[model samples]
Target chain A: MKRLRVDRWTGQLLLARPGACPASTPRTALRPAAASRCAAVRTRSTRAMPEIPTDEDYADGTDHTRFPPLEKLPPRATSLPSPPPERALQSAKLAALHARLSLPEKLPLQTLARALVDNSADENPLFNNTNLAFVGQSLIHYHVAEWLMCRYPRLPMEILYAAMKGYAGPAALHHVARSWGLEHAAAPGGEVDPGLLQFSLHKPGNAIVTLGYKRAEAEGLQKYKWRHGISSRVVFDDDFGQVVETDKATQLRRADTEYGNEYTRSLAEKAYANCARAVVGAIYAHAGREPAKAFIRSHILSRTLDLSALFSFKKPTRELALLCAREDFEFPIARLLSETGRLSRTPVFVVGIFSGKDKLGEAAGPSLEVARNKAAMNALKSWYLYSPGEHVRVPSDMLAEDAQPWTPAYIDMGEIIGR
Target chain B: MEAVVTRPALSCCRRAASSAPSSTRLLLNSSLPSGTRQKSTAARTRRALNIPPHPSFLHPNKTPESVASRPTSDEIIFNPPSSAPSVFHTPFKFLPKTDPRRMANLTSNLFASSTTIQYNYSPSSAASPSAETTTTPSPESFPSIEGPPVLKPRHHLTPQDIEQMRRLREQDPVTNSVQNLARQFQCSKLFVLMCCQAPKEHQQKIKEQEEKVKARWGPRRRAAREERHRRMEMLFNGQL
Candidate 1:
């Protein structure tokens, strides 16, 4: 068997497009990208020339096109940043994945292959998942946001953002992709199978999957931990209601983080998330909107997240009172419902918070004060976590061809502000 | 915990159940949801719920007192141990109608463990205590007479009482502290704090004094405090 050419022919492929005679031109100016491995591969290829067929095989008839035959470039492709787009047709794993996900037939294998390549693996936006991920991210966030807003109308902005992150953020998407059971390449290369996810942790990925306004003082959001109001977050933050990280901050983070560190794990998660988004984006691009929405509902929104567990109130009683006052309800009063082991080592008190005749919430705790506080918190949570029926109509449902006449959803007037 | 004491009763149920008509046994074994009920916890919980034990559960030589005590009525009991819930119990989630357990779960456990605590100070139980003269006249006060233990918050404070409490607290916070005001007004300290506040200067002075004390903390102590604060923040963020 003829040993693979490896990365020795990188500069050769870069210089010689299809129909160009590589034998005539001298290997004078090699790209800096191939500078390190170029010399070693050159010597190996020269020695292995006798056994392996020379460029004459390709020049004889095949690959009259501009680029090399993408279908048969695993040997030479290793030298390039990304595998040629045509290589996607020959990837068994890619086809298996397509079948497994039941992706729309219109979404070609080439785009699915391209989705596997992260920006860190291939910088060219044309080949990488950046743009597709961007499209997919927007679509995902929109669907998730509309569903959340309609379902639980009274969630505070902070909790709303948390729920969004829990549903569509990188970590969540990473798990979603993992559930699909796609294998990833050890390292990105043109020689690797198109089906495998390709990413680099050592090199910082520069892909921004969604568009958001990055404020001039974005660094302040990280360094000083300044409180940016919800209004500002709505205007200036990313889709998940997070301050957009400046490129400099990302670079600094990458520099300090060691190999196999949490940052690296995060980078891997983000890449996986991007890949999932790109698949959706490809669907939207190829099939249509309905299929894409169906994909999101099945993959992303179907995942369980306990929204009530997201609340963290500093002054629950005060907040509950404020919420009652704003809603024109009677002030909440906490009454002890029961006490057990009161004079023993561990006392348990159950408290219920009542507003007029209605008992809003109840909780049991180790002490009367703790129980009262917990009950108050529970009351505030119930008020904030109000949900229309699980099947409440979302705005996206209106986008369908046979949707009903739109019904206005009732969203609360933001969270109750406290002293 | 390792005793596994319910087996004997279970064996008796099986023997009695097997001898009962085949139709009744088949009804008892009808079907559970198609899951291999995992682990000992589920098994133990299931065993604990074998209510209205089979007739053969009683030993041949068992005394009359045991049979006499147990109610023969067929009413279902709401008793649940304060531990892992019985395997028959389904949680309050929006389960679809198709779930095999949905029908049973919907019909039961609505008030599971609601009245677990049955002990409260009754009037008869408190007859020995006689501290009525030491208590205030307000009905909201922890009654020295110790009538029935009341869970309801007493709406005994009139507008004048609230106004007077506020006046006293405002005039001299040192004299009318939360504990002192609660004692004088015959209410809870929490109620006293809610009714009024100490002057702004006193609050400021207290805050400043706290700051001074915090400033004097050693570096190790400061770091521990900072770490504690970070953990609390993480707890709120759901990262803890």
Candidate 2:
């Protein structure tokens, strides 16, 4: 058996023979990524002058790429002897450090290999033996999962996560939900159900309905009502000390106020409309496409009627006030009547302020535009409330023929009656 | 000397509504000329230019012929009725007469008697005491009647009565409009202002003055008030 001499001094890979002339052998054979190890191996031992082969001895014609044969290998030579005390100690130390740095079986690539194995599983593979893992296991994965669900509902969740993040990575679903206004509904059996999403806990009663998820309850799981629309109300009262500037202040003081004052009531109405729009946007996230018809009828128009009874004011006062401020009132009234055609009910009417016995002004029709036209006409004519001589005709061609007739009624105009 | 009452100030309340763009405006009625209907080769050539039709105005429903088909309802309920006289000249007596016969003819716990003392007056109730004097006419120095007087029953007031009350309230500087003042006193403005030239803290003063008047006048007034209460209880229970 060939006894290999381990170079303990410099921690080199050495093959040395002891107690006799060393047999000629090539020593510079080891290919380490350093210079000193190769040099040490080459000069370590020499007993071979017999058939020492030089570098040019065998230029292999067969395959120049392959290693040369072993018989024509170089001779090894011995140089300085090992230092007595410190030499062996240093060698042992170096050997230990090298071993610690590069363990024979230490595999750094195992983590990467394991991840890849879990990622690519075979179709219908066995559970334990398979090396596949679902790609989307994190919140980031869910975000991509939801985004894909938005545009393409049937896309695989793992592929979505992988494609969205490029690799299986982190994502935020809440942010995505807010932007698209769609969310997964909570369903039984641990599966997600696609639904028009809403984040609010309060079930708002409105025309639009949001998709919601909730745990099964005694009330039943689907019993969770979702709100997809918004509405606001404003009542005028002296409790606010007559003049409120901001919409926020108006809402804060609705309880103790009277709805008799048109100006404040009008202001409150506008604020409510704005608030309703915001609420609709918040819940369903699509105010543009949706006509908002249901939102108007249910929250604004219906609630205003109920409020009329509560405020002791006539219902028309509140409803017409809202209509007068509607968006489409700017168009000519003739055009409005022409399109919507004749109205069955009088638009909303405001009593004239300048007539001898101020007559009630009548604005009628279902759409908010017609209502405003009638109201504005009454205001312009000062109806029965103002003296005809002093009445101010508002400048607008929007008033239609049906809105022309102003009937006077006997009302005590007080001392300023005809002025 | 009726004081002029100021109009109620406009409230600073915001107008409530989410706005939308105005829809296309159209004329109430206009028909296209018959000649324009013919699609001649030249007209068809012009039509290829794709210019919007000379914006022919039509009603929103696209039918300009029937503008009056839809009659909209006005919400204000208190406008003066048509065919009524232009000037309001009703007498104060037109105000709901609170006579005993009218009161007894009704059916509610409360009735507003024309008398000075108003007791549980539910206008719907129809029980009232009939007070009549059968003896010879009393002298100029007639003795004051004891207890609440059985006044006429005033059921409901007319608009003219309301105006009169408002006018009467306007005469007093310290008083607000009749509508506002009536809300506070829970009564007509005509009578309340009649008692005071200058609006003072009179309720307290009257309570104090009444103490002296009752002491001097003895139990006659107290007995009258008690009778008023009794009549109220009877009226409330449907007991005549």
Candidate 3:
């Protein structure tokens, strides 16, 4: 393979083919030799080089020469908010991370470096990873939602939203980024390493760039503790079914006074989450859908989450009764199946909830009432936790060309009784 | 053609009961004849499999005569008519005894009986049994109540009552219990507790008592309690 060197002043790639150095042209000639010699000199030079050319020097358009002074060129030539794209090649950390993730060869280091530059670090749209992160967020949310829907068809809306957050929310993704052994720059600037995650800690930027419609009452939502219906949230909120608060702009304006340790920590978390999303986005853009989906499944969806613990039942017994009524079954009745040491301080009572002759659920507790309540709760949980099978196919499975004719997935009639 | 068209609309209304409003039902009812409408409504309310018995006038043989005549709803009998045993009843019965899941199932099912019975005996009846018992305590031996205790009506406490309560609390804050004050004032214990102001010393004593009780908990119990609290926090934070 022929080595290529990017011209700093003109922003053009000059290929150095073997035995053809293009010596006849003045500007093109002596480029490869001088670039190689400068690299060797940088390693050997004990003292720092002289100050690089200012922006004016590039604008003056100096005359072409056979031997260009490589040391006089700026350390960073790009005027972008982030480090120059050429730095991606020299970053050892970036190379290690790319290999660690086993990323495809097609996914270039430049895109990976761009993924690390959060919007908070670089406000410029051309340089930052905002667009890539947006694409990644959509793909991640779509796969997660479909999998969760097919896997546990009976999860209530609240539990479903909670599960989605548990898998793909900022805090969860922050943990994902940390597990990848990613290091963040102390502060984001053009001088910082391109490999390190660059995001400002003091200034709270608009880190969340989602394709969601903001409700008019969003301003008053947190301040007034407004009631946002679950259905409304599905329409107006972000992918996780949460209200997308765009108050970060206002918060940033007050950053001088409002900036605290807690605020900075949360900002760091959001920045890390965005970086993870951007990486997924870069994979999709470069390598296409299959690899990106595989990456998400292996990393994010593979994590364990206890779906049963997401329930917070206010009245389990009443809900069970209503469920029986709705299903037109026999009214649920709690009965004491057995007891031991009833008079003792640590008495145990076993209770069972029966619908007709079927023992719906059973549980043991310290008291008869507690046991009965727990039995009722368990019965409701079992009914809600029904699954057709582990390998139930989702809608996305039909996207494959050779997939068999799609069969409709089993969907329950939602929660038996809403709170 | 008319019958075929109406059949789809009728079935549509029936299916719409779950998702649509009752206005569609009203529209369907207006089109139906009164006589058939009542019959259809009754059929819609009936469950899929279990057909409830009609009145005796409508069906004489369907009436339940005794305890055995009616099926008990005490426990659910799977495959009510089938005598075959359920596969789920002993799903892991084939597994080795040392398997954790099998052991859990075994221990859980140890007290899985389907019935409960309670017996009661009178003292006088017990005393007369076998003719060797001592004199039994008669019903009149205990003082009889005239009637049920009357609950004090709300909003009956005067300004003077509040003043007296305050004075009593101020005089002996440590000795006064919220319950005793409530009984004296003929009000709820919560109201009395809210009204009474505890001194700093009393508050400190209460805090010390709570701490003492908490200190008595074993390491395992403490860890379990903390774990429960952490799980609750995770649930609230939507991280679980």
Candidate 4:
């Protein structure tokens, strides 16, 4: 039989001489014999297996390596040149002084003072409203700017960015722009040329509304990029002032009804007054600040306004409407109309689901009262869809087999764009 | 002294009468509350199981009453159950004394011997040796058998890669169970796992229709798609 011999220490087997038997070497061969004998005996007298060296062994080796033999090194302390005694003493003194100052408690306050002073020099964009616009005509720009300043006096540019982006609307944009102007715009651009006004009002950031028209304009002259901030790209020519006022008035007129009862009459007037003020606040802030840029942004990109306060007003209006409808109150629609005023004059846009014959509705007149009466007549047919029992569905012709579904679109303007 | 001597004598007499063979046992029964004597007899049987026999306590007669009175016969006297077992019953037969009193004795003994050994070769006069060794280190010296080495994590590992690898392994558990594969890949078990794939069940479920999407777009889209496809085929055939 062929046999292999192993070096016991390495656990490696080696070829054995043809004539050699098991006990060829005392050290190597004896280990296996002893191991075999231990297995065979199976008694308490059996010796334990030898341990294998592990990573810890190398760690111990490295630990001992810390102390090198002095004989192997050039005797620098005795033979090599050393620093002069005076210099050494000076260095030791300096090092001691440094060590003493390095403690956290011992740090100098001047460093802290410098950091604080350096931060204030930065340009704060929250103060600049040249790029924002509100949705109201009567709103004095200063009032909106003042409210924004009071509401968020010390907000950083990043926070302002988030608020504007998150709420993106004509109302919110107007508030931001007014605040921005009160804070940033030291000088206003030249007069609004008729051509520039027309072009800019249709651009994003220029006209703040529910459905911004600037984005859909043919020329697309306005850029949508830095409706954000600090893009040295172009000076803005926003026209949210004109576009929003025209479209918004149309929406209000379509939803309003005549207020007959004393209570219903009073609330509708107040809601209208409050909304008008909020719209004015939203618009003037954007107009007064960076009217050009702000107008274009509101009018064009994101097709939204800085009308944050409008949402707050709408909340109560919606609740009151629903409450009046559920209780079958005598003049619920009248109450809604009273607060809303003539829908055409209402500063904010009111949207509802589209159903029934006409796909669009709008109205216009000299006063909001006259305009809203005409618009409400247009929107009345679909009011039942929002009522308790009416079933609402998208028109069969409007459904797409393979496309993302969107919210139903409707118009409240007294103007009938398409029958 | 007389009381002690009479007590033993009485006990011996009791043991002798009780230990008589059965025939004589019945005749010699002393009626001094023999029921109590029966109880004492039972106790003696228990003590025999515990203690080795002592010659002085063994009775001549093996009757129950005589067995009760012998000092060894007093083993028949019932003792209350102990809260802890006797040291003799414990598994550690050769355990060192642990009682505070015994420990004090051992410590004093060690101190006395060590002091003597030192003094035998010293020239100092007498004083308490305990005062001198009070300065030595205590028995709690060895640090809680050094705990296993702790491992710190390497923070430089790429988080994105790790997350991706984890998702991959989670998706393929059947093939990824091998530990060696994880080691070869140098990734954690979670990192080796793959994420769940899109469920076939979702595909099988039917969705309810509300408004058809075409109303949102327009019927012109069909014509648009056909025109685009026709253009594509024409280009593919090198005719466009």
Second chain TM-score for model 2? 0.19
Task: List per-prediction Cα lDDT, in the order shown.
Answer: 0.68, 0.27, 0.66, 0.29
- Write down the worst ten-residue block by lDDT for model 3 chain A: A14-23
Cand. 2 TM to true fold: 0.16
Per residue, candidate 4 scores C-alpha lDDT tens digits across A178-273 of 332212111111111101111111111221223223323323223332242322111222222222122233333333443244433332332222
Looking at model 3 chain B, report the run of 10 residues with the lowest lDDT sum: B111-120
Which 10 successive residues of model 2 chain B have the least lDDT summed?
B9-18
- Writing each residue's lDDT as its tens digit, candidate 1 over A157-207 gives 888899999999999999989888887888887777788999876676776
Candidate 2 per-residue C-alpha lDDT over B143-228 given as tens digits, one digit per residue, 9 for 90 to 100: 21122332222535556765665555546544454456655545654454543343345456667887887777658778988897
* TM-score of the first chain in candidate 4 relative to the native first chain: 0.15
Q: List A-chain TM-scores for all predictions.
A: 0.81, 0.14, 0.81, 0.15
Per-residue alpha-carbon lDDT of model 3 for A1-419, expressed as tens digits?
A: 85554455332222211212212222233124334311222333232333234547343344324333333323434334577665555566787898899998778887999999989878877888999999998888899999989877778888899999999999989999999989998778655667899987655556456767878988788889889888888788887788876666555655546656566777888888988999999999999888998899999999998776776776677788778777777666676656799999999877666665556666677766666666666676666665555667888778777999987776666677653
Clashing pairs for model 3 are A356-B75, A357-B75, A357-B76, A357-B77, A358-B75, A358-B76
User: Which lDDT value does model 1 have at A53?
Assistant: 23
DockQ, all candidates in order: 0.06, 0.01, 0.01, 0.00
Specify the CAPRI tier of model 3: incorrect
Give the C-alpha miss distance for residue A368 in model 2, angstroms: 42
lDDT of 4 by residue, B140-227 (tens): 3212111242222244447675565456545654454435335545644333433223234432331212234444656688689788
Candidate 1: tens digits of C-alpha lDDT, residues B1-240:
333335565565567568889977775445422222333686677777666543323211234544334544553454344531121221222122443444565432332222121222334323222312222112122112122433334778999999998898889888788999887877777788888989999899889999999989999999999997786565444343
